[model samples]
Target: MDIDHLTEITANELTAAQYFHGHKCPAMPQGLRAGHLAMDFLSVKRARGGSELQAIVEIGDHHFSGCFADGVQYATGCTFGKGNITKRGLGKFALTLIDPAAGRAVRVTAKYERMKMCLEMPFFEQRRQGIPPYALDPAVVDPLIDDVVNRQWRDMFEVQTFNHYPVEPARESFEAVECAECKEMVVLPYARELEEQRYCAVCYQARVFRGQASGI
Candidate 1:
C-alpha cells in the first residue's frame, strides 16, 4: 500500500473531479488532494454507490471551503446520496476518510500556514468581494487550482492516521412505507409516528413533535 501520493493521482482524475465539482477553486482541489492521499495511504479503492468507505468532513454550511466535501466525494466515492458522507459542522476544512472494513482511517487537513498563501491569492480576493467562484475569470481561478494541484503534500496537508479506528457500521434500510401526510415513501426507520399515523420527518408536524407547536 506504499504508493507515491504525488504520482499516483492523474491529471484526468482531477479533471473529472473538477467537472463533477462544477467550478475551479483551490479548496476543492485541496480536498481532492487530501482524499487522494488518504485513499492511497489506506490502500483502498473508491466506493461505487456503496458504503465501502466513509468521509466525515469538518465543514459547516455557509462557510468557505465547504466545496471540499465535493472533492472528497469525487476522490473516495463517499457521497451523501449513498449515505457515506457526513458533516461535522465544525467550520473547518478537514477530512477523516475511513475504511471501515479494515478499521483504518486518515485525517487530512490543509496546513494553515500553506493555506494562508492560497487565501491571499487574487482568486480569494475576488471571492471576498462577493463574486462567486464559478463566475470569476478563469485566469484568476485557474492559477490557484494549478498551485493546489501541484503543491507537495508535505507543504499542503497535515495527516494523522489510525490503524484501529473505531467506526459505527452503517445500517442499510431496504423497506419503505408511505407517509400519512405528504404520502411519499420514506424508509421505515426514518418514518415518524405521531398519533399512530406515520409520516416522513418533513411532514410529521415537526414543531409539535418537538413540543414547540400545538397539537402534540
Candidate 2:
C-alpha cells in the first residue's frame, strides 16, 4: 500500500514483449495516468458505496498476458472485475510527475490506460477509509459479500443452511418385554419388539445370548 514503493517498482519493471516493447522511460506519464486513476476511484466509490482497491501497480498490458500474481491473472482487470468501469472525469485519474526537490509535477497526455495506473494515491485521501482496494472486481466481490452476510446470520442465531426438519410427537409404549431370567422389563423404543429381548441387561453384557437364542 506504499505508493512510493509501488512507483519505484513500476518504473523499473520490464515491458519488452511484442506489444509493450516501446521506449522504456524512467518516469511515468505524470498528468494523464494519475488523473484517470483518481477519477476512477471516486466514481467507483460513489456507485458501489465505497472504494475497493488493493495494490495498484503500473505495468505494460502485454507483460500481463500469461503472468499471474497470487493465483490471479495479471491484466485485463482480473484482479478486480473486467466490467468495473468507473465514471468518466469525476475523480482523481490524473497523471503527474514527481520531483523530490522541486515538487510533484503533473504530466499532460491524451488518456491513461488502466495498466498504466500507479499506486501513488495516498490512503488518507481516499473517500472510504480502511476498505481495501482488492475487492473492487465483480468476480472477487460478490461471493465474498455473500460469505460475510451469511456467516454473520449463521453465527448470531444458529441458523441452519437448509430447511428445518419436522418434529415428530412422542409415542406411548405398547407392550413391555420382560426377561424371565432376571424379571427385568424394558419398554421398546421401537415397534415390533419380538426378538428384541434375548437376555437381561446384566446377562446381555456377560454373553448370555450364546446359550439362550440358538440358530441364526
Candidate 3:
C-alpha cells in the first residue's frame, strides 16, 4: 500500500489508477450482488478524545455501507488503525476495493483508498507468512466479502468519474425480513418481479407473500 519507496505516482499514474478505479470486477452470480462494507474504527492520539476514530468503509452500488468500532482496525482492514489517510493527522477515510467491470469500486473514495493502501500492505505481509486471498477468512465470510468489494468497484465507474480507491442499509426496513409466523428469516428471489417469502415451505405467510395464496 505504501509506495513511498517505490517510484512516486505521477499525474499519468493517477489517471491510470482512476481508470482502473472505474473499470474492474465482472458481473457476479444471480444470487450474489455487489456492494460495500463500512467498518468503523477508533483513534487513540487525537486530543479531543472520548472515542477517537480512524476510517470508515464507503464503497459499492446503492452506497451499501457499514461502520465498525474505531481502533478495531483489524475488523475494517485499515493498517493504520485510526489516522487520516492523507494527513495522518486528520482522520477522515478508510481503505477500499476497486473493481471496474461492474463499474463500481469498494471504498472508492479518498478515505477508503487510503484505508486500502494502509491495510493492503500489512495484509500482504501476513499473506507472505500464511494468510491467503488477503487475510480473508477462508471459509464462510470470504465469498460475501469478495462479492461486495467487486460490485462496489464496478459501481464506481457507473456512478462517477474518479481517482483510485477501493472501494448499507437500513430498511427500507423489511419487518418481514424475519418472519413472525414461522420464526425464520425470509429470502427474496433474484428478480425484482419475484416475491419475498420464508425459506421454509410450511410458514403461514410465505404463500401469501409469494402471491400464491389469498383472494387471487
Candidate 4:
C-alpha cells in the first residue's frame, strides 16, 4: 500500500507506535488512519499536550483482538497520560474527533462490510480460537497485516461530519486534598469524596471492597 496516502503521520511515528504497542497488527494501523482522517478533516494540528484535541473512542473492552485505542492515541496524540482520549465503550469500531475551538467534529467508523471482511480472515479465526496474534505463525500473520496496511482508506471507514459537537471545557485547575485513610495528598480530580472525607482512587476502591466483604 502507498503509506504516503494513508495519513499525514511519518514512517517513524508508525514504527514507534508499533514498538510501543509491541506488535504490527491491523487494529493499530486502522486507528492511525482514523486519527489522521479526523485531524485532516478538522484542519487541526496534532495535540502536543493539554486539550488541543479530544478523541472519543467507541472501542469496547474485548471486541477486537488488537489494541485499536492505542492506534488512535498514537496517530492523534490524544493519549491517556494527557487526559484527552476517552473510551465510550459502545462496542463499535468507531471514534469521534473534536476541535473545541473551531466547533467542528466528525465521527469516523469502520464500514460494516470492511469489518466483516476483516473478521472473516483466517487471522481472526485464530483470534476467535483464543490464539494471540504474536503466537500465530508469522506466515499467517504477515499477510493479514499486509492486507490491513495496504487497503485503501476509502474502503475501510465512513466519515460522518458534524457541526457543533459539545466540547466540554478543559480542566485547567484542580484542588489538592488529603486522603483521610492514607493521609497522602491527592489531586481532587483523582480523589473520591465520601462522607466528608476524601480518598484516593486506590484507597477508595480498597475501602469499598473491604466494606462489601464485611457486609458494611
Candidate 5:
C-alpha cells in the first residue's frame, strides 16, 4: 500500500504504540512517520521475525532521542526482542532501514526546521525546565503529537533511498552452554573459556579479576 493508505491504517496502531511507549510524546510518532515512510519507499512490509528487516537508528542513549527509537521500533517491527535494531550512538534523529535480502535500504532523518520548532514549543520549554514529559498537561503535549502525526510526509523528513546498500546478514545462534561458575545458560558465541570450563562473560570477568588480584 502507499504510505498514505498505510498511515491511515495506522490509526489503531498508534494506541498500541503509545501503550508500549509508556506515555505520549511527539518524538515517538515522529519516528512512526519516519519508519513508515522508509518502508513505503522501499516497498517492504513491517518485518515479522529473524532479521527480515533491520533498523539502524542514529539516535542514542540520550534524554531526547530514546523515545524516537521506540517509535521506529514500533513502526518497523525491528525491535530489540527481535534483535533487528542496531543503535549507532550517533545522537541524531535518523533511521536507516535495510532489507538485506533485497539489497535495499532507505534513510530518513527528521527535518532540522521541524526539530527546531519542536524545541521552541512550550512542551519542550517545560521539558528543559526539568518536568518529565508524562508530567506535562495533555493540553500542552497533544497538539504537538497531533501535528506530527498529521503533518505532510515531505515536510517531516529528508528521505533517501539506496538501491544497493551493503548489509551483512546477522547470524542466529541456537547453541547454548551453561557457565561452569554461574551455571547460567549463555549463547555459544559469548561463552568465555577459563581453565577449560565454559563461563558467561560476567563470571569470566570475575575470575580474571580474582586472578589478577591474587597474582595468578
Candidate 6:
C-alpha cells in the first residue's frame, strides 16, 4: 500500500515502526504483535531501559525477507542500543520475554499454520519472484498488512508461560580492563586475556589474524 494508505489504516506503533523500518511488509507487523502479546502476558511495561526486561528473539539471518528485528525493537523497547535484546539465530519465529524482578517469563511462538498461510499468500510468491512489496499491486499488499495489523493474538501465536523462571538481575559491577594493543578500555564480561594482556574481542581477533599472517 501507499504511504498515505498505510498511515491511515495501520496502528500508530506499527505505523511508526514502518517509518523506522523503511518499508511495509507483513513479517514486521508479525514481530510487533508478538512483542505486544508477550508484554501483555508477562504483565510488564514496555522496557524504558535495559534492566526492566530482556527479550531473546529467535529470528535467524535467513528468515522472511524483512526487518523483523526492528518491529520487535519498536514494540518491546528491547533494542540492541539498550543492550536488552539478543538474537538466538535458531530460524524459529519465537521470542522469550523475561522479567528479572518477578522471575516470570513467557515464550511466544508464531504458529506453524500462521507461518504457512503467510508463505502461501500471493505476497510471498511475489517476493520470491523478485517483486518488492511496494512494487506489487496495492490490492495484493494491503490485505496482508490489514490481516497482520488486525489479527487476534490467539489466532496468530502459541504463548507458553513459565512462572518462577529464574532470571538473574542485571549486573551492577564489572572490572574494567585496558586492551593492551588498542589501548581502549574493555568491560569485564567481554574482555579477554591472552598472553597476560587484556583485549576486546575485536582487537583480539585482529591480533590473531595478524599473528597468523606474520607466520605465513
Better of 3 and 5 by TM-score: 5
Tens digit per residue, CA lDDT, model 3, 1-216:
321121222435323432433321111110012112222111112222212222333323321121221211332223332232212322333343222222233332333453354344433345446643323444433443344333333332222322443322112222435554556665443112224433344454455565654555
lDDT of each: 0.84, 0.28, 0.30, 0.82, 0.88, 0.81
How far out, in Å, is residue 52 in model 2?
49
Angstrom error of the Cα, residue 91, model 1: value is 1.1
Better of 3 and 6 by TM-score: 6
Per-residue lDDT, model 2, residue 52, is: 26
Higher-TM-score candidate of 2 and 3 = 3
**Winning candidate number (TM-score):** 5
- Which residue segments of model 6 deviate by more than 4 Å? 1-10, 172-178, 194-196, 205-216
- In terms of TM-score, how similar is model 5 to the real structure? 0.93
Report the candidate with higher TM-score, 4 versus 6. 4
**Residue lDDT tens for model 2, 107-130:** 222233422332223321231354
Model 4: how far is 26 from its true place, Å? 0.9
Off by over 4 Å in 4: 1-10, 189-216
Kindly state the number of residue pairs that clash in model 3.
46
TM-score to true structure, per model: 0.88, 0.19, 0.20, 0.83, 0.93, 0.82
Q: Rank the candidates by lDDT, best first.
A: 5, 1, 4, 6, 3, 2
How far out, in Å, is residue 64 in model 4?
1.8
What residue runs in model 2 are displaced by over 4 Å at the alpha carbon? 1-156, 164-170, 189-198, 205-216
RMSD of each: 2.6, 26.2, 17.1, 4.0, 1.8, 6.0
Between candidates 1 and 3, the lDDT winner: 1
